[model samples]
Target: MNNVKNLNKWANAHTYLSLDLVRIALGVFLFMKGISFITNIQYLQDLISPIDKIGGGMFLIHYIAPAHMVGGIMIAFGLLTRWAIIAQLPILIGAIIVNFMGEMHSQNLLLAILILGICVFFLFYGSGKHSADYYFKMQQ
Candidate 1:
């Protein structure tokens, strides 16, 4: 708990407008990806075919789109951003695994890795000073 508090303090001290913009962009990207999955579920199924063969892929299919959609919104607004990112972590990890397990599309793999990296960064960084999290904290 002390470690988390210290990390949050360090992150808050390092907050910048550019980081906030990047967080917003990341949120929008994830949201769009969710929409894409919903619109073309077959594409998502194909991507997850390797996992599907092992079973429980159906559950993941259902979980991914909605989590991304809702979590993306939370992340964008910096409302419970850490929690939102936590929810997304599994999906992102699975995305990377699926790329390797199945047919590897360089583009998809790269995108997943990049997004995962950003997510991990934000996990530690927390929302910046410009975010709803900071605004609400200030209000309190």
Candidate 2:
């Protein structure tokens, strides 16, 4: 019980360090990928060409790119971080769905899993610095 108290004290003290760093890293990583999804239409088409070859409309592709980019920006900015992480789930899931399973190994899957883990972490524990939760704490 005493050990648990000490651990909790340490956690609360270091909250800003671990939480903010993770949030910033996650945000930037998502931002770059988001930009790629939005700006590089040809790339998106190439990877998912099977869908279109079978008659997936231009409309779906058009919307997906922008949505990915916008979602990335929101995550990076720590605006609705949980929602943004939740939003990214589809794009990664879609990649797994549309891509040949054999083409992906554990490495690729791990990256997706890692991103989801990061999102889940932030969802449960808000970015602790200069974030809405932090501000509220400061008020208290």
TM-score of 1: 0.95
lDDT by residue (1-140, candidate 2, tens digit) is: 57634544454566766567677777777777767766777876776665666675486577666666676666656666657667777766666555554355566567777876777776555455545544555689
After best superposition, candidate 2 residue 49: deviation in angstroms? Answer: 3.0
Q: Where does candidate 2 have its weakest 10-residue lDDT segment?
A: 3-12
Candidate with the greatest lDDT versus the true structure: 1
Q: After best superposition, candidate 1 residue 28: deviation in angstroms?
A: 0.5
Give RMSD to native, each candidate. Answer: 1.0, 6.0
Q: In model 1, which residue pairs have backbone atoms overlapping below 3 Å?
A: none
- CA lDDT, every model vs. true structure: 0.90, 0.64
Error of 2 at 99 (Å): 3.8
- In candidate 2, position 70 carries an lDDT of 71
| Cα-based TM-score, every candidate | 0.95, 0.66
